[model samples]
Target: MLGTIIVGVILVIIVALIVRSMVHDKKNGKSFTCGGDCGKCKGHCH
Candidate 1:
């Protein structure tokens, strides 16, 4: 019904946001946990 459509749209938006964020982080050379730099390692060590 209408409610289901709304929920689907919201989920899609949320997923799109998450994907955008992940892509942005990747372009900036960052990891989810290491925050772009793994101190103990060398260059671009994500």
Candidate 2:
């Protein structure tokens, strides 16, 4: 119905925004795998 369509559209928009934010962070050199605990990292975060 109309409600279902609206919800789907909203879900898509939210997902797109999340993806955009992740891309922006990546462009700024943000690391998603580094938990800021370099002591336990596998030395690949850099």
Candidate 3:
């Protein structure tokens, strides 16, 4: 019984970690820096 609870907790934690890293946090990183608009800038300030 106790072991089953521990295993369930571990599985939940593993799933949480997997879900956490599976997607990108759009706000935390740079936006679309693709060279689609190079016509406006001499060179990217990147």
Residue 31, model 3: lDDT of: 28
| Tens-digit lDDT string for candidate 2 (1-46) | 9999999999999999988987887787766666434456767767
Count of backbone collisions within predicted model 3: 0
Please, what is the TM-score per model? Answer: 0.73, 0.71, 0.50
Clashing pairs in 3: none
Which model is ahead, 1 or 2, in terms of TM-score? 1
Best by TM-score: 1
Which pairs, if any, clash in model 2? none
Query: Could you give the C-alpha RMSD of every candidate to the true structure, in order shown?
Result: 3.2, 2.5, 9.0
Candidate with best lDDT: 1
**Over 4 Å off, model 2:** 34-44
Error of 2 at 10 (Å): 0.4
Superposed by TM-score, candidate 1 places the C-alpha of residue 9 at a distance from the truth, in angstroms, of 0.2
Instruction: List candidate 3 segments past 4 Å from native.
Output: 25-46
lDDT, model 1: 0.83
> Candidate 3: lDDT of 23?
38
Better TM-score candidate (2, 3): 2
